[model samples]
Every structure is written in structure tokens, then in C-alpha cells.
Target: MGSTEDTTSTTYSDASSSPTQPLLSNPAPTYPYPYPDPPPASEPEPTQFLQISYNYGPRPIKDLPFLLLFSLFALSTFAFGIFSSVNRNPNSSSVSSFSYDSTTASCVKNATTSSTLRSPTFLPLPNSFALHSSSSSLLKSLIWTLVITLIISVPFAFSVLVLLKHYTKQIVYVSLPFFVIVPIFVNVYWFVACTVSSTCDEKFPLAYRILVLVFVFVIIGVIVWIFVVNWHRIELTVRIIGVAADALSRNLGLFGVLPALTLGLFVYFVPIVVFLVLARLNGKIVAREEDGEYYCVWKQDSWVPAYYALAIITMFWSATAMVEAQAYVISGTIARWYFSKDGSSLKRSLRSSLRNAFGPSSGTICLSGLLICVVRFVRAVVDNAREDAPGMVNLILRCCVNALLAAIDFLNKFTINFAAITGEAYCTSAKMTYELLRRNLLSAVFVETVSTRILAGIILVLSAIYAIVVCVILKAASNLGVDSYFIAVMAWVLLIVVLGYFVHVLDNVIDTVYVCYAIDKDKGEVYKQDVHEVYVHLPISRNSRSASALVARTPLVV
Candidate 1:
């Protein structure tokens, strides 16, 4: 018994000491086990997934072929214009004096010296006495008009910024109601005045009068409905404008950049204008009589008309390109400012954005500009056709063309904003923008209307005030003569354009912020928490689920 007990103790001690003995006895579960360590915790089911391959550095050139094609076309056009101008005859008579002879019952060329006839040529040359006498005062008036517009617009833009930043709610509240009420009041007043006037009653048919009244009522109803629908969204619009104002205030350098771009555009236009003038001189001189005076007229070549069209189209394209480039710069810089990490500096953001806009993205800009130019050209044609033939069909055609132009404009607004942020090609940016808008339809519609109307109202008021101030100043201080009306009108239009630029910057900012917010929502992450919070109040849509499902199907790339 003592030996057995000692052996048992030794065996138990050996069993305890041997590490593999218990595993062999128990025999660990094989491949058919019901569970296995919960699959190593499953990576926490990521809350935010990648959507776009967002690039922070310079992106590869997109739509390069389009860029090349546009460059070739522009260069060819310029070369042809230069050639035409250079080959034009400087001594060609624009017009020849003709006298109507009663004896022959026909027109006859007067025996006049070329030099005398040329002095009163009808081409309105810069050195022509008639134009030369008025050109100085006209030029002086124009110079003063531009100077006044700049002076007013610069300060007005800053004031607008201040108002947008600090008084956005007030501006929106005031402008919204004013716009809604004023239009209705004007329409109603006109309708009433016309109804009360016997002359109007006699001139217009009863059916037309009834139609006008119905239209007025319908417009009032529609306006009220819109106002009511968007009333709740005023806060969101103000927030958006405020955000844009903040961005603009931070990047005040944009103001300087905008003027520089305008100057560059003006410089570009000078040569084109010269080309147009020179091209006009390429035609034959003909004698014509107007208002009892025999004068020489420049009969433009057949090709001259076509070349004028081309040059005008080019100007339109260039203007559109410049506008888009401005938008891209604003959008890109704002995006950088929006996504920048905390405590980071963005001193070079504007420069980087400029490089991106005119560098790899220039082709995209050119393409968009071309589309706008084409649409505008088509619209102009439709307008002329409508005037030539007033009918239901032409009217309907005009409406359809106008609608298409509007659609293109709306799509471009967001697509350019998206491309600015993502550095995507135009087509890709357009597709993505469409998807985003589809997902957030209500927000987009309401915010767009509210913001656009408010800005329009601001522009109108500011322009009117500036125009009045200009007229007063011109009357008080300058001897512009009849040019006062011309100067006032020019100054008014100029102020509107300058103010429009400011509005455009803000418009792009609003769009960029909305797009960035939509992206954040899609990714389930917020780059701008404040914007997210403010926009979170936007009514949710059922499309969010489908958007999420689509995201789930897409593989996330690290």
C-alpha cells in the first residue's frame, strides 16, 4: 500500500507537469464545432465608408482631348481673323456718292473726289468727323460711368458680405416678403388700370383681356404657394448664405482675383473688337443715299457675316469660360476651407485652386462654356423666329428652348461645383451631381429658390440705388450732355454685372456647401459638423435607404 500510494502521487505529479496530457485526454473539438471564437470581432462594422477617391493633391488632367480640340479651334479662329484683318484693303471706300437723276429716272454716281467722299463715309470710323466730335465726350462719359460703378460695386460687395454674414436672416426676411408682395401688387395694379382704361378696353380683345386677368390670378396663386412652401426653409437658406459669407470673408483675395479676371476679359475683347472692325472693312464700297445725303456704305463680304458670327460665338464662349473658372476657383478654395483639419493653415488654398482651375480643369471649363454658348445662340435664334412669326407653335418652341437652357444652366451650376471639389471630369461630375440631387430633391429645390430670389432682390435694389446715385452725380458734376442717359444706363448695367459676380461667388459657395453636406450624409461622416447640424433639419427622404443600399453594394477601397 505504501509503494502504490507513492506511485500514485508520482503519476499525478507527472500528469500535472506534462502540458499536452489534458489536451490529448479531452481531444479539442474538430472542424464541425458549432462556434469559433466569434470570427475575431468582425472589424466593428465601419460607420463611415469610402465613396469617392477624394484627391487632395493635384489631379490628372481630365477631358484632355476636348481641351486640345478647343485649343486648336480657338487658335485657328484667331489665325483666320488675323489673316483676314491683315489682307483687308485700307483705302477701300465703304460707300460711294450716288445722285438720283430725274432725267434718266435712275440713280447715277456723282463725280466726287475719293478724298472728299471718304471724309463723310458712313462706316463711322474713329477718325470720321461725326464720330470724332462725339467720341471724346462719349468716351469720357463711359470712363466716368465705369469708375462710378467700380467705386459703388466694390463697397457694395463688401456691404453685401457684411449683411450676409451678420444680417442674413434680416435680408432674407425682408427680401422674401418684398419680392412676393411687390410682384403681386404690380400685376394687380396693372390689371386694374387696364380694366379701368377705355383705350385699353378698345385696343385689346375681350378674350385677351380675360386671358390676361386669368394669368394674373394664376401667377398670384403660384407665387403664394411658393412662398408658403419655402417659408420654413428660410432658416436653412440663411444659414447657407451665412456659411458662404464666412467663406468669402475669409478669402477676401477672391475680390481682387475677380477684378483681375474682369480686366483680363476686357483685354481679350479688345483684339476681338479690332478684328471685327477690320473684318468689316474687307467688303466692297457702294454708293447709297440716306436722308437726302449721298454716302458710301461698306457692303460686308458674304464670309464677313459668317466670320462675325464665329467671332461673336468665341466671345460668348470666352465670357462663359471666365465665369466658370471664377466659380471653380471659388468652389475649390471653399472646399479646401471646408475640409481642412483643425488648426491647419490654408494660406495657399486660393493659389492651389487657381492652378487647378486653369491647369487640368481648363478643358472642362471650355466644354461647359461651349454648351452655354450654343444654348444661348439657339435661344437668340428662337427669339428672333418668335418675333418674325407670332404663333402658338413658335411660342411653344421658344418656351421649350428656354426650358432647355434653364435646365443646362441649373445642371452646370452643380456639376461645376462638384468637379471643383472632386477634380472629376465634366461627365463624371454631372452624373454624381445628378445622383446627389436625386437623393436630396426637396432640399435642393427649396434652397435654390430661396437663395436665388433673395440674391436677385439684393442685386436689383443695389443696382437701382447705384444707378440713381450715378445719375445724380452725373447731373450735378459732369457736362456729359445726352450721354447722361447713356452713361446712367451703362453704369446701371455695369453695377448689375459687378454685383452679379459677387452673387455668383455666393451662389457657388451655397452649392458647394450643399454638395459637401450631401456627401457627408452619404458617407455617414460629417466634415463640417455645423453645416450638418443645420442641414439635418432638412426633411429626410426614402431615397436615403436606396442610397445606402447602393453604397453597400460598392466595394470600399483602402
Candidate 2:
């Protein structure tokens, strides 16, 4: 009995203590299982440099600036040459402006031959530093201020909007008493201030006249509006802005203070000014319906750029004028101020400007001149095509554009009669937009008054007629025991062919990138453009090169 009991106990203990007991049980164990949470859907960040790669298509337009600047330099030099030749005592064509002291004598002697005579060339324009303000600060400020101010203002403005919904309510009845009482209080204070003995003299003239007019107008307008049914809600918008300013200040920091005011004024007054001017001068903006209100609808989506472009044009005109003014004015002032001192820098700068008037920097002036041609061509095409678009604004703007183009054409026809330097279209939206277009047109032109662009356009025409001649010459060379002409010159020929194709392709691709789709990402901000237009820039490329390993996996998004 004792032996059997011991065996029974041992067996039970062994069975209970086994490692596979869970398997033996009804439910199997689940050890080392994975996490229960679902994976989140999210996009990964792209390499920073990839954004810049996608910004400019293929390679940048480099030879363009060389062309534009060179042509400008050449034209100016040619003009001066013509002037010098005509003004020379004996009217000798031998006295050309291309005569530099080193190569001057040779140039003067070789003026008759196109092959030997060199076209004037110049370096590109120095990129200005003033554009940094809009770049470094404007975007940053917009980002920090936009959300805070707009969000906070929503409640108060919406409350006022709700109030407007019940226009016939007692609430509308009370606004009158407040407006009337406030004006009376203001009048009383003004009268008290005028009667004060110590401060009366300073304020008596302008203050009294302004206060009396305000008192009279406030009394009359408020009184008239109270009795008048169906009051215009548009007039109460100024009050909404005041409330919004209060809310914005309460919620956001110091930066938020100005956004409320600026945004409100821009939103309200931009249309006001646009419409008023269009009404007066017949500009090209048409009032169209959206949601319920009227807005200035441009013919093409690109025409919206006209608004911004006009503004940019005006702003840059002001900036350029200011820069030119300051450059010359400050330069002259410094020369006078430091007359007793060394004055070398001042003197050098003055001489530099004067020399630039007749020197290599005429390239920049010529570029400016060239922009005039481009602007006119584009304006002409857009204006003429959309001449019958709706709205008085469109009609007026079209007329203005037509006039501007005609004037430019007149200048082109009469002023030096330059057909070689004149055909134009551009996609220079902005530098950050990755549009780079420049041309060294003078290279072919000064050679024979025919341009490279013109030559490219005519290459198709010449190909059909001159192809037989080319084949014949190549055949002759092949037969002449000249082992293979291409084999001898393959490297240089390939390089030229590759580089020329590269430049043309780069220009076309970049222009397409800018006009069709432009994306600019700065800091953490993304700017994806839905509407694209012609933007002007002096061509430049980012300094990133040789980082192929990076910027390849994911495309940068704006």
C-alpha cells in the first residue's frame, strides 16, 4: 500500500511540473508574440539637395548670360564705334572703339574684315544683395503670424457675422445709441481740450476744424443710418477689423499684432483700389462671381501674375530707382566729403560708373534694354489674343499693353534698327523658382548681324537646301585618303555637339519647369505653385555639385 501510494504521488508531481504542461492543457500558449498596434501611414522626408535638383531642370542656362551680356557689350561698343568713326576729324572708319591699347591698333587695321574683327564681350551683372530682405524675413514673418492672427480673429468676426444675420433684431437697435453717444463724448473732450489755457494754441487750428467736421458728419451719418432700412453691411466691415485686431493681440504674440491689420486692409482695400482704378482708367480686371461676391477675374490664369507682376514691377521700379539714386548720389557726396582725405575709393567708383557708361558693364544696361523687348513681345501676344475679354479692366489693360508694345516696337524699328538682337520670350519667374535664361546673342550677330537664336531657327531651312552639299564634301574628304575626318576631330566635334545641345535643352527644360510647374521650399515651409507665369531673372545656378549619392531616393515636395 505504501509503495503504490509513493509511486502515485511521484507520477502526479512529475506530470504537473513538466515544461509542456500548457500544450497538454486545452489552450496552447502564445509566447514572444508581435506588437498589437497598427503601423502609421506617413511620408518620409526627401534629401534637402533633391529639392534644388528638381528646382532647375537638367543643367542651368549658363551660355545665355554670356550671350546677353556679350551682345549688350557689343552693341554699346558698336554704337560708340559708329559715333567715334563719324566724329573723327577726317571721318575715317579706321578709328573704331574696339581699339584697346593692347589690341587696339590691330582692331583698327582689321575693322574691314568680319573674320578678324572681334566682338566686344563683358562679364555678367553683379547679383545685388538688397533682394535678401524678401528672402530672409518676409516668408518667416508670414509663417509665424498667419495662423495665430487668423485663428483668433475668427470668433469675434464670426460673432459679428452672426449679428449681421439678424439685422432687424434689437441688437442692431442698440449699435446706434453707442455710436451716437461715443461721438458726443469725443466732441465734449475735443471742446474741453481746445478751451484749456496751456495747450490751446498748438491744437486750435487743425484740430478744431477736423473735430467740428467729424462731429457734424458723425451726427448726420449715424442719424441718417438709424432711420434708413436695409443698411449696407459693407460699411460695418471696418468695425470687424477693429474687433479682429483685439482678438489677434489677445491670442498671439507681438508679431501677430500687425498681421490682423495688414491682412484686413489687404483683403478689403486691394479689391477696392483695383475696382476703383478699373472703373476710372478701364484696367483689365473683370468682376466675376465666386461664392456670391464679385472679384477681378483675369482672362488666363497667367493673367493673375499681371497683378503681382505689376506690383513687383512697381516695387522693383521703386527699388531700382532708389538704388540708382543712392549709388550716384552717395558716390558724389562721398567724393565731396572726402575731397581733403585720400578720396581714392570715391574717385575710383566715379570713374568706374563713367567707364561703365562706356565699358564692359554696358552689358547690364543692354540686358535692361533687352528686357524691354521681351516684355513688349509677351504683352503684345497676351493683349492682342485676349483683346475681347470681359470687364472694363481687361479692355483698358489691353489698350495699355498694346500701347506699350507699339511704343517698344517703334523704338526697335527706329533706334539702331536692331532685328538681330530683338526676338523674345522668357520664363524668368524668379531666382528661387529655378528659372535661368540668358543669351550671348552678340557672338553670332557681331560676326555678321545674324544671331544664334535666328540661326537656330533657320537651321531647318538651310538643312534641306545645303544637306546635299554637306554630303558631297564629306564624300570628297572620305575619297581623298583623309583616313576619317570625324575620327581625327571626333573629340572636339562631340564636345561641341554635346555642349550646344546641352545649352539649348537646358534653356527649354528650365523654362518649362518654371512656367509649367514651380515649387520653392524654404526652411520648413513649402510653396507649391498652382498658377505659373513669366518671371524674369538673371540666370544663376545653386552652388551644389558632385553630391550624387544624396538627393536621389525621394523627390523633394513643396
Candidate 3:
């Protein structure tokens, strides 16, 4: 009995001694002051996305290939079989390596890791179990069959079950937006709804989508019905709703209050929230190790909290949009069709009008952005098209193209302001920064916004022109004619595109005083104060050295 008790004690001790993951309970490691939790938050509370207290620890199952290969050696231990995680099936191809040619020459197609999402597939998976497949292809195939079969039958089971239960009918309404907000969690439920859910699936397979849409039509209809029935009763409601929407969205901003547009807005804001959370969590942002030394700059940022707050704003706004948009679509139709309730025969005709509104209303926000892209697309094509060499039409087209270019530049600036704040720069990196600063410091002059834009554009155009012009001039000299003129223009056009982009990069680097400032502070961040950094002396101006001029002139493509 004493030996048995001792064995039990050892086992318990061993289990308890294992390291467990720590929770991010809103306190820093350096500050050992115990975390005083905030008061409970409720509706109208500042929005916050809570993280689950548990992490799956690190990926201990690295080099899955070896384990898979080992499974083939089951002859050694007579254990050659499949290894599967719970909720996952074991399959043959599941052990096989999967690879594909990628978009940007990366391991994953884009040569980029998922910056925000945990999954390679951004859309949440409801039914990917085991995280591994079966060793037997036939077995894997059978599992898929069962999965599909289950998906097909479950929906009907649910709809019929719910229809029979009176209490379940109202529950559907309350449960909808909850699913809307975190559909990722109850993915299996939605997946079931998608398949064999109901005959209503024929009309609207997504019962939630139909219910929401119907609800929208109903709400809008009631508002219209009230307005028409009284003929003049609630001037305040109409004015408040209409004016407030327009006022809040005077800037080219998203409107979250209305149902006509909301889902896309939710998608748009998700990245913003994700970025903030990641920045707070990222090892790079929190601290850095260099030359056997470590540095931290976490609490130095004041806007850290604002990131979370803004994400909350994005979520609440999205939820509001889903609710309000649903109300409009559901109620508007009823008002238009059934408002009078007394021989409103023409009210049936109102369906045509409502249909027109509802047609594009479902994705109006997405549609608006799409339209902008279309406009940008057209502008890109037209600008690249040949122009009359010397005519008013040419001038007009040029002006229009220039205006479009200007608008795009402005829009990009606005986008940056609205987007999650980023601390990194793309393109030439520190080299570009050094060059621009060298030019600036040497010239002892700053680039005016217009000159900056034009100067960069000129360098790129000149470089590209040089390359294309050299090529075209050779062609023209060999067969000089009207073709010569065309060749010259071609040189000029290609020249503009490449050189223009080069200068654009150069100009952009100079403008980012903030980034340069950060770099100067790098000793305090990335590198240790002790280790010498390789610094390049750069020429920063128009009248600069060969390195920068080559940067613009060497462009084969923008």
C-alpha cells in the first residue's frame, strides 16, 4: 500500500511539473504588479475582442514528413499503420507531402505567410478534423462520402425539428446576427444549413440569409406604411435617419448603420483589428535580440490601446449595418407592397421598384469599391492608349488621365490613413532611405510636394525613355519613316512608365520623415548599441550620384 501510494504521488508530481502556457491577462512581464482586472463590460461597453486563455503551445509536431515516413516502417514494430489526431481521419495521401507552384515564389502561393489569420485558408473551416488524412485512399474517400451524406441530411433534420417546435421559431431571429458576428465558431451549423437544410434551401438555402433579408423587407415596409398611413405623421424619424447617415459619411467612408451595405464593411474592419492585436503580440514589435543583447520598446507607444478601441468600433459598426440593412430590405417591401392594407393594388407594382433597390443593395459597399476599381481600370487602359500627337482631343485625354492619376494618388493617401498603421517600408528598404537622406542633406533642400511627385516621375520616365528610345531610335534609323515617329513615341511611353515608377519610389522614401526617424532610432531597437551597423553614404537629390540615377535609369519595368 505504501509503494502504491508513493507511485501515485510521483505520477501526480510529474504531470503537475510540466510547463503550462501563460495567459495574456493584460499585464506585462517586467511589471510584476498583479493584474487588476477591469470592470465587466456589457452592451454600450467599449468593444473588446477577448482572446481565449489557452494557446495550443508551440507546434511540437514539426517535420510531419518524418512521422509519416515512419508510419510506413510499421514492419519494424509491426505497428505500420496510420496516426490520426482526434476528430481527424487517418489517410494515405494525408501522409503525402503537398506542394504547389506559388504566386510570389514562396512556400505558400503568395511567398507570404498569412499576416493576420491563423489558417492558410482565410475562411474558417467547420469540418476539417484530425488535421491529417488517412493512409488508405479508399478509407479517406469513404470518410468524405460519410461527411457529405451527413451534411446533406442534417439541415432537413434541423429545419423540420425547428418548425415543429414553436419556441425554436423566435429563437432563429435572435440567433442570426450572433452567427453573423462569429460564424467562424459555429461553422458546422452553417455548413449543415447550406446542405439539405430545407426546401426553403431551394429558395434560400441559407435560412439565416433569407430570414435576415425578409426581416429587412419587413422593417422598411413598416416605416413606409407608417409614413403613408398617417400621410404626414413622423417627420422626425425620416429626417433623422436620412440626414444622419449622409452627415456621418461625408468623407468617402463606410456607412455601417444601414442594411443596404454591411458585410463587406465587416470584412474591411477585420484586418484593422487583426493588425492591432498582432502588433501587440509580435515579438519584433515587443522586443528584439541583437548581438547577444535584448531590447524592448513596448510601453513606449501610447496608441496601443487605440488599436483595440478602433477594432471595437469596426465590429459594432458592422453589427449595426447588418441589423439596419436587414430592417430596410425586409420592411421596405412590406411597406411598398402592403402598406395601405386597403386596395393598394399599385403597391404590388412597388415590387419592381423595391427589386431595383434590393438588386444591388445587398453588396452596395462592395459594389461601390468595385466601381472605383472599374473606374481605375478604365483609366489605366485609356492612359496607356495612343493619343492624337497634336490635337485638343489629345490635350483633353491627357488632362483626364492626369486628373485620374491625381485622384488615385489622393485615394491611396486616404487609404493609408484609414488602414492599420504600419511601421515597415517596402522596396529598397534602408538603402533607399539612406540615398534619399544623403541627397537631401547634400542638397540642403527639401522636395516640394509637386516637385517631389514630378521629379520622381521624370527620373523614371527618363530612364525608361532612355532604354526604349535607344531601342526605338535604332529601329527608326534602320527604317526611318512615319514608323520613326511612332517608334519615338513608344520610347517615350515606355520611358515614362519605368523611370516614373523609379522616381516615385525615390520620392516616396524622402517623404517618409517618420520612417527615417525610426531608423535613426534603430540602435535603440534592433541592433545593439555595441555592434557596428553597415551604413551606406547615400546621395539624396536630383543632382545626386550615379547610384540613385542608376536606380531610376536602370528600370526595365516599373
Residue 305 alpha-carbon offset, candidate 3, angstroms: 1.3
Tell me, by lDDT, which candidate is best.
1
TM per candidate comes to 0.69, 0.18, 0.19
Query: Which ranking of candidates, highest TM-score first?
Result: 1, 3, 2
List, residue by residue over 1-558, the lDDT tens digit for candidate 2.
555545544544444334232210122212221335535534443311222211111222322563465444434433433433343333122233233223322222334455576878875545534455434443443343334333533453334334433441433444544445544554666566566645565747766657785767777575566445424431332232222222222222212322333354346435433532332222223345558654433232333334444433433333332222222222222222222233233334333323322233233334434555466457857766674576878877778877777654333221211111111112221221221111211211121121122223222222222233333454564342232223223322333333343223222222222221212211222232211111112112222211222222222221
Better of 1 and 3 by lDDT: 1
**Top candidate when judged by TM-score against the true structure:** 1
Mark the 10 consecutive residues where model 2 has the least summed lDDT. Answer: 416-425
What does the lDDT read for residue 109 in candidate 1? 62
Over the full model, what C-alpha lDDT does candidate 1 score relative to the true structure? 0.74
lDDT of 3 by residue, 365-434 (tens): 2222333444555676766664426577877887887687765444332222111011111111223333
Query: Cα lDDT for residue 203, model 3?
Result: 65
